[model samples]
Target: MATATTHGARDHARAQEGNRADAMPVVPASAWPDPPCAAGHLVWAETVAGGGSTHRVLARGTELRLTDLTGDACAHLLLFAADRPWERLNTADTVKVQWNAYLGEHRLLLSGQGRVLASVTADTSGRHDALCGTSTLVRNSRRYGDGSPQSGSPAGRELFKLAAAKNGLSARDLPPSLSFFQGVTVREDGTLEFTGSVGPGGSVTLRAEQDVTVLLANVPHPLDPRTAYVSGPLEVLAWRAAPTAPGDPLWEATPEGRRAFLNTAGFLASRGIA
Candidate 1:
């Protein structure tokens, strides 16, 4: 005996109540993994500003987490053997040895000497660019006009030079660096295209296999088409991690991964490190 209009009005009221329930605030969860070490036992932690840089010496078994505090950020990174600075990350070698152009979780970052420098144990931002190198002053000036370290428009290359100098390196020592969180794809015609792939709270964790010097620059990707030179802050956290064991994700990722781990283990054994 209820009219159709009355039923319609009741339904509408119910829908409105549902919408209000859905809009209620919920606590946000962390995108990063819990610290490998106990709480308050981190070796170091810092937040690098946009267009800024940092350098550090990471010992073997050290776990470093890089988090994009905001979305659409790029971190240009380079690595070198602390003892032998000449041996550094080789992008071509890493790509060729892995038999893949895409770098994500479980990929080993190899040095030019065919040894493992670091292993990507976990990655939320699945895509990283290794083809296009870091941006240079000349390239930045041509794209964004007035690319000068003094003007606070420091390019990735300039940042690396300054970071390296602090560790007794020179401009000539700079090598091609890996740009994290910047997605690059291969087109049908063999051309490379850049795309946005990371969002706020996305992160990547790297576990060092050898004593290495890490250089990082928070800068825009060379292929970033944005007219504004906006970069975002990145949070870095380092801690001691447990030793890698057999059947680990990184160890069983590929045959090459196992081989690289063996090589690194041999190197460490020679140095009297377990």
Candidate 2:
């Protein structure tokens, strides 16, 4: 049998030196005190490559911002209450109760129990989706030839599963996700139109309404009509901020939104969180 270790053996010493990261992997909170997050002290920061994944446990009042560095990134996000993992994102109820499919600033992400898991505080990327979640392994393989995690075009579901497993979750705990940087609109005829990102540098910030575990898969939108796998990188940043107040304007924005906020407040109060 032939062995292929000759080159690697000669370059072992050099490999470690060259393998070091070219730049800071994470941007500190004080690195940039910019708009959107100008007031808060950032607590977490990361950049998930295309087809990659990540997870975060955010405390209530922490705001997370996801950016599509390039115009092709898609963010599939799943949320679970940190204290009670069983309570998770319920998109159907989010859309049904809100009476809207498209999402933007001031929109609340509701859980099955009618609690506001998170709320969109800022959104520069107008394109988002309540329909057509993220891509799956079967679909990725059918389209790109290989959907394995090691492949060039990995499935969003598999990436999510990997992220979830790190936080002690499993496939059964997985539910449909809410996608960002990509969108879908239903016409009067009941057909679907997929919308890609408006442009590069688009971002959406979500404020945790409760202490929550957030799982993110930065992959292509399943509905993207493109034949090639051309997604871009995703930037995840979180900063410390105050949660909603009882008399805040968002709480009174709509009858439905107010009810969701009230439910969230009740849960917090019961836990003696004041």
Candidate 3:
């Protein structure tokens, strides 16, 4: 007879313990109120602990939302085209092409080829950074004494390395990352000022303009002046949604953005990707 506390993988319900698969999406309605889409539409959901990392391949039109559950969760993000590994997120072009330093809704995350990889579809947390990038092993070790993924103070780059490898990518594929929730400001002297994250429950959402592999690390912002390695929980939710269309308002927001969208559409069409 099986005990109430224990059960086999193929147990026939004799045990009363709570069990679930490793890859099960949480109940959408129970997870969060007012989700962008209905429960059935939700495709992915997970809560990454402080100083943790996550990776996922999102299909075109998927909407991913990252929430600062404790207000200090810094989401370091990297993106790569699912089909074409060479086409990766280019933070420099993302900033240079847009000619905007700050990020908000409707900002298209572009690739080096000037095509849209993802776009900021919704944002309640206005603070974001594309300049300082993520914490490195050297920086973390100097500041917190340990920089490995198992350490209390893990380097964002190292974490991303491990996540990237899971997707057949290497350190070279890990391009400069983008950080959300933690931000910076430019001083008059052209130096950077760390405007650390504040306020809880702030969330930012992005829509996949093309199939993309997203890698992330929820580590402390590199510029975070705090000596202690303070990390927080980050909630991730993704759902199926409609991809951008030619008539979308964002398509007409700017000439540069319009061009990027066109380029992305052309590529998708050429590949017969829907």
Candidate 4:
């Protein structure tokens, strides 16, 4: 249902479907793949101690591989269209399309436009964590505090705020979001609290249907400090991703917020946000 396929096969099929005679070369395992910057191109990235890149998947058959390089690491992933940042990879729609929680090698990252962005073709470590989250504070702390180069740009929170505003979401509705690598737990009162790292080297893949702007930043896992620290480090890795057509499903919930996400997207598109 999610339209997932192996790297080689997917690319070949997309090439045939698009009737393109010329395509770019593939990524070598030893090198970091770079994504395309075309109007409809889509790409994925995995962040490590040192910044890295991914080879751009131009065709439907293109496949992406993200190596933890380390044992267990988390990646905060976000998606946007290369031509239209407003028309993005809505997480809520993705969850709905899959009709399940906890994405892994078994599941494919889907887009609101009904296409595969990436797929987890292989993984050495089976300890991929779901429920991780990302935000501006987390990115800043990890990058600047972790001895990375100084960032003259805005932080995650700021960027998110800007994106939200551009998407027509009020500041009140836009909160810090978590991506791959954060952890969470339901409480007795049915409350969701943040946890820590899930594990290390937990990689995930994303196949691109169209061009997307993927932002992977390190951040604190979703958890509430007040709760008991029963679980160990919580980590999540996202391997698959894709773009959706107009009026597509994203995220995996029946909550009002998720429904509104779709409505908001449509509204944005009406206003030319997409």
lDDT of 1 by residue, 30-84 (tens): 2224645676556656678778888889888888888888876688899999988
Candidate 2 ranges with C-alpha deviation above 4 Å: 1-40
Error of 3 at 123 (Å): 1.0
Best by lDDT: 3
lDDT of 4 at 268: 44
**Candidate 1 overall lDDT versus native:** 0.82
Runs of candidate 4 exceeding 4 Å displacement: 1-47, 50-59, 69-72, 113-116, 120-133, 137-155, 158-178, 193-195, 222-274
In model 1, where do residues sit more than 4 Å from their true spots? Answer: 1-36
User: Model 3 TM-score?
Assistant: 0.89
- Where does candidate 3 stray beyond 4 Å? 1-35
Q: What are the Cα lDDT values of the candidates?
A: 0.82, 0.87, 0.88, 0.42
Q: What's each prediction's clash count?
A: 0, 0, 0, 70
Clashing pairs for predicted structure model 3, backbone only: none
* Candidate 2 lDDT by residue in tens digits, 1-274: 1234877665775665534342123544455435346654777767778888888899999989999988888999999999798999999999999999989999999999999999998899999998887888899999999888889999989998888899899989998999999878899999899867798999999999999999998888988988999888888888889898878888789999999998999888998996
TM-score of each: 0.84, 0.89, 0.89, 0.46
Order by lDDT, highest first: 3, 2, 1, 4
RMSD of each: 14.4, 3.8, 3.9, 14.5
